[model samples]
Target: MTINCLDLFAGSGGFTLGLKEAGIKTKAAIEIDRFAVETFRHNFPKVDMHHRDITSFNDKEIKSNFTGVDLIVGGPPCQGFSVAGPSQYGKLDDRNNLVLEYLRFVKVISPNMVIMENVKNFINGKLPSKDKVIDVVTNILDKLGYDIKIEVLYAPKFGVPQSRTRVFVIAIKRGCGLPFPEIHETHGPDKKNYITVGEAITDLPFISSSAGYDDSPDKLTYNEIELSTYQKMMRKDGKGIYNHISMKHTPRLIERFKHIPLGGSLLDVPLEHGQRARNGTDLDTKARFKMNNQRLDPSKISHCVTASFQSTFVHPVMNRNLTAREGARLQSFPDKFIFKGPRTLMSKSLLIRENREHEIGLSQYNQIGNSVPPLLAKAIGSAIVKSFKHKVNDTRRATHEFA
Candidate 1:
């Protein structure tokens, strides 16, 4: 009665890790990013990793290989439907069509269950063809005899120390009589309080912006401090601290950080210190994004970590930006889950100017920010596992009675 899964668009195996934690076996994964694929292969060496685009495979090829998969999980590129994407394009962005590619695989695989994750805006997004994305997906699942349930899950409520929210579409095949999985919130007012940023990362050793390197053997050993419950869980199987290196900020940038208080953003900085311009021209005007360079309030959950998180979150107490490991901790990634690839990447403009777009790949920060929190995924996966076990037990009892 083991459940086998095929993970599509599996960036760095976040979903795979959660499924594994929930006692589900991820038989295979497909990812297009070379660095992410390498990370996935490194972490999940036994899984069949396909390092190519999902659209490259025809329906016949998918069916021939993934015919018996019990579950299919994916979070297709959300840039097109994300609120962070360019608003001018809105639903007309070409990347929004990737959902169709996701559906294509689902149609061919016809797994017992399907789970799709995306940014919160995905619930209201529409394709270029003037059809709502959710409506289109639901119609297809309905035609395929699936019972669909969609929910927007909040990360903090699920024990993640980040205030991120995403939409999940869960579909179970008809005739199984298995109701939708019940994913209960474990960290809220009625339950345990939400894990705080301090609880999630305060245990890691401190390092200056100039300390640590990418993929270097140099690692800061953990201190013998009293560990929090969240810290104990994170360090359960971790060998040592890795990817805890901070970004080297300019002296001026460090000075700017001095003006911002805890939970304060760039708006707190004086205009003389190169604050962001308002209306693209009024540099003297006090206007800044709440997400940009905001010092973390250690007492509460963190703001959403986006793919550009390399420059998004300032450290809670330090006058530097968060290291890749700190962001990973906020996202509920265990300490043992080593992120592979460059620590950071050049800006998109620089890459384009230097004609290095072809060499583009996900950096450690990008991979961390792009991932679903493993703890949240585990909660959802646990519910699915519970329902599956229940179905299996009922089937066994019925067979015994018949015989």
Candidate 2:
């Protein structure tokens, strides 16, 4: 029997992509953003998409959508729980409380297994200590008689090119007693090397920031490559890769990139160029150096890929920041998974363009930044499916003995 899943806060279906890869069928997904909904449909046309606010989601409606889901996978919105975003007290209306909505569904649907992902700050943040979150979550699951396991996983360790750290909680129905998912150590003394930025993007051709050329809407073009290994692997299939959103750079941003050396930051540029450098620590400054290239430190891996263009995500080799496609590649989204919607349509577009004056899809870029790497999602999906199957097996054995 096919393992089925109900995905919550399913942004662009990154979690769904992984679940599908791990052999679980996504029966339905709930998301609020119209852009994310469009992107999800571009990839998963058949998934039952509920574009309603997660807070308004109905448990009975969800339960009626599927008979018995083997797994539930999702992340509640993380702004309130995120240390990076504005840290509001856990208010009743705070988006962070959507975790309760997730719990409500768990109570109603009672899936055999549940998998959750969120920013690492969810565990380390001060407002809601990790313990508090776990206690509440575990209590709910415990009431339903399930054993839970939680961990903070780093994505690069799982073959994703970028360094993304997230808190993951996995639970299996008790009495079945399934073990937690094994960590796939792909890098270091124990295994092969962790995925690298160079390994992820060596295939695309180079495009200068000033160039006003556009490829056919169907066939996308890659602008840079450091090596052929990553490039060749990404292009293994002829269908061409997806999620290739490149932004146009302003004259000043382009000049700043030109002056900044490889692995150097905006601070590295001379003061003559109207920029300043940090004295000791990384404060929010345009003058700070951006670590654009992926360095080969076997002990430490790459930095987390974020959606903000102004952040320190510049190309290691190129003069400007890493484009949306480059960021997506680092996150291990397949080549065919294209993103929709223009970047400048969001509320923050004016501020972004005023500061940088770039004509790229800023909102869509942020979505990609906020998304869970689909490859990592697949790993979580696989683990959840395995745990669910183990529970079903135990159930069958108990029934047979009674018979």
Candidate 3:
């Protein structure tokens, strides 16, 4: 029997991609964003796609359209619940209701397993009513005959090169006992498996700061055609890697990047801001560094690859920031998995640093940054599959325990 699934708020299909890798095929995906939907269709062509907002999407259609969904894999739009976006006391709106929509489908479909991913803080995040979202979800899942299990997994520890932390809430049918997903740890603090930024991108061609979109293959700087096991797996059947380009940085931003050292944070820039702020040639400015921004540390695991990472993370050796593809690589997306949309996913936030500009939706960077690393997804998917065929013993014991 095939384990069918549905991906909700399927941003660029990252969760779905990993679920597919682990034998769970998506019956259909619902995404409102045009750019993300295009990328999803381009990659997973056969599956049904819906561009309607989930809130307004007729709930009855879910049952009428599909059945026997062993799993429902996806999270509601998290911008409202995210600690980075807004405080619980503020910004309450319809977006928060999307999670309720997710539950509505769950109530109807009653999938055997439901896996939801969200920002780590979502576990305890609250709505304006002062009701904890996690508590509400736990209550709902319990009443729905699901045994709830929650774990916050860090990407770096689970084969991803970057240090992004996400919360995975797994609920299995009540008869299954606790649903513990097996973890495939590729890197860790003690284990050398933690992939470094350099190891992740060393093989890709060096891109200049002014680099634009290119549809050709990147020139390899290193010899020996044999790729690292990580590279070989990620490069499988990849053709002209699309969306591997750089976002145009302002001249002032370039000057800012010059003063920041590798792996430093925003607090790393030079202190001399007023005098000769625009000039890079000033001796005082050149020497007066006070920690400007975060550049990738090639030797160590990368920090979180966020939509604004390019604005902050400078290349370890190179003077420029990571291109879209390099950012994708850091997120552990294979080369074959192409990202299609505007070359840059610019939003109102960019206006803070850039001129007035606009786009239909997310760029490759946002898609990648916002995605659950496929490696992490694959691990979770594989574990879920295993629970069906074997005892729940496949569970990886807690490495770094968090309540």
RMSD (Å) per prediction: 2.1, 5.3, 6.7
Off by over 4 Å in 3: 88-94, 176-180, 189-191, 212-214, 218-226, 250-252, 272-292, 349-360, 391-403
TM-score for all predictions? Answer: 0.95, 0.81, 0.85
Worst lDDT window (10 residues) for model 2? 292-301
lDDT of each: 0.86, 0.66, 0.75
Residues 162-268, candidate 2: write the lDDT tens digits. 66788988777765556666645444443357766566765654445533222243455555545445456445453654444445677766776666664455556
lDDT of 3: 0.75
How does model 1 fare in lDDT? 0.86
Please write out the lDDT profile of model 1 over residues 1-403, one tens digit for every residue.
7899999999998899988999999998999998899889989999999999898999788987776799999898888788778534543787778898998888888888999999998887878786889999999999998999999999999889988999999999999757789998888764249888898888776777767655553447775789889999998887778788888888988998888899898877887775545454535544566667899998988889889988888888888899998899998889889998888888777898999997688999999999989998899889999989888888899999999
Best by TM-score: 1
> Candidate 3, residue 115: CA error in Å?
0.7
- Pairs that clash in candidate 1: none
Per-residue lDDT of 181-223 in model 3, one digit per residue for the tens? 6666656567477888877877776666776454655532322
Ten contiguous residues minimizing lDDT sum, candidate 3: 394-403
Residue 34 CA error for candidate 3 (Å)? Answer: 0.6
Model 1 residue 264 lDDT score: 91
